[model samples]
Target: MNNIKKSQLFWASCLALLVTSLSFGIRAGILGKLGTDFQLTATELGTITATAFWGFPLAVVIGGFIVDAIGMKRLLVMAFIFHLLGIVLTIFAQGYWTLFISTLLIGIANGTVEAACNPLVATIYPDNKTTKLNHFHLWFPGGIFLGTLIVILFNSIGLSWQIQVAIMIVPTLVYGYLFSKLDFPVTERVASGVSTATMYKSVTSPLFIFMFICMFGTAITELFTGQWIDVLLKNVTDNAILILTLTTGVMVIGRGLAEPIVHRFSPQGVLLISAILAALGLYLLSTLTGNAIYFAAFIFGLGVCYFWPTMLGFVAENIPKSGALGLNLMGGAGMFAVSVYTIFMGGFYDRLILKKLPAGANEADYLSAAPGTEMANLLNEAKNAAGPEVLQATLVIPIILVVAFTGLVIYMKNKKKEALTH
Candidate 1:
């Protein structure tokens, strides 16, 4: 502990996470541009986006298994290499497959950063795992806020998407340098002398499995909507990216103040409340129009702000024996679910818009129609109608979460009572 540079390592992890999140934010901002430039459909764009989610689980689950053996520094190095390659590839991406591969690389980098950092933070701050983890995770939405602002700025100035992506390299280099200079401590599992078999067993426990299932809902409720905000709300709002920016901005504040909040409510209680707010927010966004969308965005942000870190923290604190594997598996499962859901949402959106088209009209007709022409206007109206419907359909996720988190709260309460009685 004395030899390790805890502050430097933790901040470096934040910087690495910033890089990961900037990719998400920037990608969200550029999806429209990519679609137009490459002549891609909603489904194709979704596939490219889904690669990032799917690739995340792949790296994270594998990294979780091997992080203790390979060392945190090594994983950080892998993240750096992958990030550099991915960003470069994306800058030069010609079409679908190239975009898919590049985004996958970035996703892998993102997951590796989480694999190394989550356990690293837990090990370093043994006493304040949940609160500090929340604090550490603040950079996620913080970076997204910054990334969205950058996109807005760059777009206003007529800059290329390549330039928007290249900005990521600055933070990537800094994190790589900072991580290289630090000495990392062993994971909490290793430090506590928790055996590998015990960690494995704990992750497979009923409690862990329940949380794993719940993660699918929580993650999609937050991430899928965030990633697709520009598309989902484009028709409903004048600037959908602002909704993303505002949502992430709210998240930055919420996560920053998470210590007091988590102290007051307990992580489970907070999650339960978050799910309710998120459900309400999504429903409002689907049904509302005009300036009301910003209000809904604020609510959505508050609901999801604590979700990721709090989920990780709960596991770290209550299921201490599960170690890094549990944290990574939770994250992996969430991302994997989002990957599958993204494709489904994309296809669903396409179908909805198609149904809105007049009889015998198809996507090709809308695509070939000249801008502002009657056919184009019809297509725009259909998109406007379809976008909000997608959001309306997604409301089911958080509604379900309300029930699941309620169960979790009840189950945790009973566990506490049983512990005190024993």
Candidate 2:
């Protein structure tokens, strides 16, 4: 790769990722506002939120399969178009259906960014896939930090949410400009002359299948928890925005410093440690008080920081023949899991209002006393009533991850030894 094209590709990928991350942060910051403005039940709001995830898997899976065939430049152009449409539609959204569709469109755009960039970066830094992938993923948290900070500042200054949404356009335009005239590289699979059949076969291999299944748990553990921050943390602290910012901030730093860790532990070893820390963080988050919550957020951030990138890195490094198809399938599975969990968790929160509330807690009184519209008040009350139990229920995910990854790690170790001996 020429140095100029390489620099252009790297920076453009970062800028694109920043756009996706900024959208996530903005959506998270405005979730409650959307609920209030639309008078939405928690379950309805969840459907809207899940819309993004729904669009992601569909686009990501399709984009991954066709990205090599159509080229990354075309996919980048498609992403820009989808992002533009989604953001404009979202700004004008008036009801659940409109909001859902808009968010779903945006989700597809987000997924395209991943589908295109994952292989782009992998192809660019073939020898250092793990470290460079980690480097690329730092923008996920960095963008979150930037967006969240912007939201906080905008709110402090009495700026509208529409304006906050508009801020994403800046990065969108910058990425588009950077990518406009750059020549693109073929995917590693295409460049290496690996036939499509071989890539498909690799995906069905035992190792690839194992990693695909594991991806679901890791994605759920990381994203499902993040989706709940604004709701759950409200019951625990007044600094919900700060806590969100701080968590992603830690993730930015953790991912930024991942080179040494990846070298020390290897990808599988890192997954094991991340699983353990995530479980600990979730358990701590379920509690009511103390500085431990901050500590828990930090731990949780560290735990999830490398999961998505490292998972992709492992496949790129170990299952090279699987190519873009493997990367897309992994991403699609993760997003699908998050989409399913978002609705399930939302319904769980809604049900908890009746299931766990003190007998005769007076729904009307709760509604009247809480802030915002009726739906918003009801949802907040439900969260306040059941946040801890909901968090407790989520603990099962990471526990399962720890156990699953432990066996995988041991298996990988034995496999490595066998290979060395051969």
Candidate 3:
């Protein structure tokens, strides 16, 4: 790559990562306000949040063909358009349905970027796939950090979230222009005379199936938290952005150091640790009265910092010849994992009602509390009408799921090792 084109690709990747993270963070910061502005029922709001993942699966599946048929540069430019348009549409949304539609589109834009740029990065850094992939992924949290700053600043300035969301357009335009000037990689399969149909079947292998489940947990850790933190933390503190900031800050730092950690501990070990921290983080964040929430957020952020991007890297490292199709196949499966987690969590959320009324509180009081309100508030005054120990039991499900997932990842690595030795 020429120096200027290299720079273009560099900025393009950074800005793409930025836009992807901002998509969720902006939603997190504005969700409360959007709920009030649009008179959304909890059900309606859940749909809007869930919409972000709806297109991810399709984007990944279609991206394989798109990247090969066109080119990475062109596809990335298209992704930018989707993101920019999604943000633009979001700013003008006047009702719950409108917001849901807009978020669905943003999900597609973000998913296409995953399809295009993941392979782009690996092709650009073939000799250092894991290291460069980590570097590329650092931008996801870095963008969240940037978006959070805007949320706090503009929110203080009384910029309605509509206006705040509109600000992201500048970076979108910048990235689009930069990507337009670059030359993206050609398909390795095409270069070697391998056909596209052969590439698609490679994603159906047993190894890919195991990795797909692992990616699903990765989505729960990243999206379930990124999109819902403000709602989740509302139970603990009024300052939701502070918690989001802390989480993203930890994520960026963790991913920044991921290159070395993967070298030392291996990705599977890191993933194992990530799972434990994620579970603890959810447990702490769920309980409002304790100081453990902060520590939990920190630990959870550290664990997930590299989980999403690294998994994409794992597929590439393990299946180097799979090319853009492999990357997209892995990316699509990862997003599908996220969509499933979101849908599953949506089902489980109603199960979290406060059931064991603390002391004097009535069920009505718990029902009327704010979005993240804790059950402890009932305190002898409220009657808990809901299931007893709601989160107490449901959260264990995620922990179990994540732990077993880590083992599957290890199994993949071990199998690869055995194949190599044989």
Candidate number of the best lDDT: 1
What is candidate 3's lDDT per residue for 1-422, written digit by digit as tens? Answer: 66566556766888887888887777878876786666554346667887788776688679877787888777787788788788988989979777988898898998888788887777767667776788888888887877888888998888889887887888888888878767776755666576767676767777766766667667666676677666545655666667778888898887777778888866666667777777776676666444666786786688677777777777777766577877777677666765666655544543343234444544444544665556435522221222113334435645875667667667867887999999
TM-score of each: 0.98, 0.95, 0.86
Off by over 4 Å in 1: 2-4
- Candidate 3 versus the native: TM-score? 0.86
Q: Kindly report which residue pairs in candidate 2 clash with one another.
A: none
Q: Which wins on TM-score, candidate 1 or candidate 2?
A: 1
Q: What does the lDDT read for residue 239 in candidate 3?
A: 65
RMSD of 1: 1.2
As a whole number from 0 to 100, the lDDT of residue 190 in candidate 3 is: 66
| Candidate 2 residue lDDT tens string, 215-240 | 99999888777766776677777656
The residue ranges of model 2 lying beyond 4 angstroms of the native Cα positions read 356-381
Give me the displacement of residue 158 in model 1, in angstroms: 0.6
